[model samples]
Target: MSQLLDVIVAEDNIVQSAYLARLIENLGYRALTVEDGKAALDLVQDSGAQILISDYQMPYLNGVELTQAIRDLDLDHYVHVILITGMDEDEIRSNALAAGADDFLPKGHNPTALKARLRAATRLVQHSKQLAEQHRILKEANDRINDDLNAAANAQRQLLPDIHTEVLGTQIASAFVPSAVVSGDMFGCFPLTDTLIGFYAVDVSGHGIHASLLSVAIGHLITPDFFARVVLKGQEQPAPANLARDLNARFSRSENDDYFTMFCGVLNSQTGRLDFCQAAYPSPVYIGPHGNAQTVGDGGFPIGMFPDLTYENDHMTFDKGGLLVLCSDAAHEAENTQNQAFGSERLEKVIKTSHRIETDGIPEKIVEALSVWRDRIPLEDDLTVVAFRRT
Candidate 1:
């Protein structure tokens, strides 16, 4: 940003060199003079001169040869080289530019004309430095943003359950897809007992890092013996439905007015009982041994909506070889540009139609149904599907 011009003059003719150096000094700059092209090159290297003015014809090294050498050294400072030529030959002009001279000055040109060219070169140096500075700043900002996004993604991944574990005598398989650099969808697994597993899939309001952060908050509440105390505590004979109502009260105190829809359940492997609570989330589907499918439980208000709202629980009996499928609303509500939701009805038909109910097949069939419905449109929100089957 400083307006200081340090120039180097290289002319074999001693008198002409002194005159040019004097002219540069009069323009409020520091001028350096060398008698030959070699000395000019050496002085510019050590002094970091901003501009170089040299005579075309010199002994040992010509002005064009010297310009090429300057470029080969890869000097950091912007050296605006002006080649002074006595001849008006087109060959000399072309060769000067090819050798890396920025401008050409004829010998007959007056001091006034030569001064104008130097002024132009000074402006170019200032502008070039400014552009280089801007490029560095932009790259630094982009790197910081990428680093922050990667950290958020790592935290989001930790919220997911271990798919390789056997819990509650069921094999659990899951798939989570976040629409952006960060997502708001959450899923967790906690062992209620050696033979029982507690799991929940939640969708926080909004998207990106904000939604992902909220999922972490909900994970904090899914404690051990969560069902007996949070769901069935104090009720000498508490129904699964009654337990869900109690949890609704405990989670309703979030500061934000936005709601988080969740599907929570305790699966008892010994008795094949799936005690479930759904609040404004899609119901989990049960695929029978014969492939007959039915949706379980009635849904209540989403958590974090009302501080005093009540929730109801629903119960379902699953036989051996039955599969339970649960997903967020994003799975059903995903649409193409046409604005038509994939809908639960179509989702149900897909499950019942597919005779192959393998562990991986559950999520695959649902995604296939959505892909067809959305016409291959990109997912607009977080999409999650969890499938559990009795071994």
Candidate 2:
């Protein structure tokens, strides 16, 4: 029911202090009255007054001095100071305002004018306090949201595999850069045996946390137990072809209509036998040791697009020192500022001209080429690439 602020009235004259106190109380505010400027300053500091009404001439400290003392407290509380003055000099009024006084009340104002000034001051303080409170709440909420995002990003980073693994005489290297805090593109490798390695690169239909979560689900499914069942064919030994089919069937039955394009492969390091399959994904290029590049095709409709579609297994026997490069649509579909795509043809040219695939520079080259082609145009999709060499 109280709409008025906590006000401090500082006046050496008892009559003026009493008069202002009556006005303040009538206006529904609690006024703390002090006879001298020193006492007023002390009370304001102790009570945290939001408004100050002070006589211009007072013993010990004048209104200007009192205002300066209050400001020196340096508290967060906003104290709106009103100087009461009989002086008609413009210079005096300017000095009062420059000393941190918010307004001036002429000492001999009519009751109506005094009431009007107090009413206006009440509104101003209320509006300012409301704005300050809103700012505090907004800042707190923003901090909380930022903290949550950082926590989620750290968790996602932990989900990624450590980029080092060795099987037989084979060494693998991989890298991932999410377009956002998370991404839809995923890559992983698992050692199926001392001489065999299972690996996959997948790009789900969308991006962001939802797509990243789906990739996590796929990661969980790539375990030894799940792949064992997926690779199983009849009572006989499960082949790579059977693994591709089973994975597609499981994905079709369990997933939604939005398809995920992927290249899954199993490699036998001892014999240079690599059996792999693709589902509506880009064909992987085999870069032979002789510096020849050929696109290996194992095409099928992307899993989850068709329930009963069959995936074909493609086999490649690479010579020692050959390399394989697999990538997502982002690699080929990258566009320039003129809206021209950096198509698959450009990719092949880069690979061919380079003679030898520079182990460390492959990813950097792909990204650098794409960036140069973009020419400052914004990308609409995530770019991903993986390359491995058989030494």
Candidate 1 lowest-lDDT run of ten: 235-244
Question: What are the per-residue Cα lDDT tens digits for candidate 2 across 50-133?
Answer: 788888888999888888888888877678888887657677678877778888888774567667777877778788778989
CA deviation > 4 Å runs, candidate 2:
1-22, 30-152, 232-244, 253-257, 335-340, 349-358, 371-380
Reference-based lDDT, each prediction: 0.77, 0.74
What C-alpha lDDT, on a 0 to 100 scale, does residue 75 get in candidate 1? Answer: 71
Query: What does each candidate score in C-alpha RMSD?
Result: 6.1, 5.9
Where in model 1 is the C-alpha error above 4 Å? 1-135, 235-255, 337-339, 353-355, 364-378
Residue-by-residue lDDT tens digits, candidate 1, 1-391: 3556788888888888888888888887778888888998889888888788888888777899999989888875568999888656678878889988898788964788788888888888787778778877998998998899888787768767764456766878787888887778888776765766677788988877778777766665565565556655674333444444555576666576656788887777888877777778888778898889898776678777776777666678888888788878888888866787888887777766753567766776777678777887768888888888788
